[model samples]
Target: MKFSPLLAELINALTCLPGVGNKSAQRMAFHLLERNREGALSLSNVLHNAMEHITHCQRCRTFTEDEVCEICRHPEREASGLLCIVESPQDVLAIEQTLSYKGQYFVLMGHLSPIDGIGPDEIGLDKLESRLQEGRISEVILATNPTVEGEATAHYIAQLCANASVDASRIAHGVPVGGELEYIDGNTLTHAFSGRRKV
Candidate 1:
């Protein structure tokens, strides 16, 4: 009739994950406890290790163990002078898989949401502005999601680039409105990146 306190706590903890509701969390808890304790233990270890060691890359704000991410550290990528900006690290991986872009990336980690109290500084826009002011970036490609918040964030960054006299462009709508870059098809993402236009 009722779950044990420890099982209920496990289910509640699982619900902290995005998109995971009570039913799904219960299912996951049961699945792990009954079918695969070994896998669950491994996942727990990995999650704890990552949370302790991973941090935002100083330059791009992507997750990394070092001061800078591998992309920013790569000497060959620095000379390209092109920076593609996206909302999260997942978008970075998505664009990289397309192989249509050769430049480095700047991850916002999130888009602007005034109602949620997320602002420019909250999303690290000031750091991005400083990077632009360095005058090394020849072009900035906005690859944020097509959602309203993403668009607003892009426009804000575009203005920041304009103030610094750097070129700013937005990826094409081949991504579809309300779509996230991480879910877009590789071919479509390639087309969007190639067809980017000035904002």
Candidate 2:
């Protein structure tokens, strides 16, 4: 009934991933050891490299190996002057997959949670404010999730935009309440982005 120390360590390490519990971690560990050691080694190598090299984009705060992410570096994207603000990188990917948006992004990386000690600065709002004050961004679209924390973050951003005299808009409610952008279909996301209204 006892797992070897190495096996136990593998299982415990795997559980560090979000939504992966002990049983799932155990299964993953066993599968890697029994059937796919090569794939597991490859994954381990890539994880190590990424952890060492990947960092937040200086401009958008998205994960990247360079100072800025590819999206921010793209010439056409910067020229658009429209900024889509989202709580996480996954939301950016979700919107990008729809091909519905052609603009830059400012990723918060998380929603505001006062109880959890996550504040405006914790989510990179000062960086966002500096970006807004630079006057290159013409419009800011709030594509944060429909959760309470997401709404609060969006409202705060809207106020910031107002203070800076920049236009602010919120994506439509096509996305279900309490739903994450990553879970929404491409068509629905397109509709939501297209139907965004000034806030």
Q: After superposition, how far is residue 168 of candidate 2 from its true place, in Å?
A: 0.7
Q: Please, what is the whole-model Cα lDDT of each candidate in the order they appear? A: 0.93, 0.94
lDDT of 2 by residue, 127-151 (tens): 9999999999999999999788999
- Candidate 1 lDDT by residue in tens digits, 1-199: 6799999999999999999999999999999999999999999999999999999999999999999999999887899999999999999999999888899999999999999999999999999999999999999999999788998999999999999999999977677779999998987788788887789
Would you estimate the TM-scores of all the predictions? 0.81, 0.83
Error of 1 at 125 (Å): 1.0
Estimate the lDDT of model 2. Answer: 0.94
Clashes of each: 0, 0
How far out, in Å, is residue 170 in model 1?
Answer: 1.9
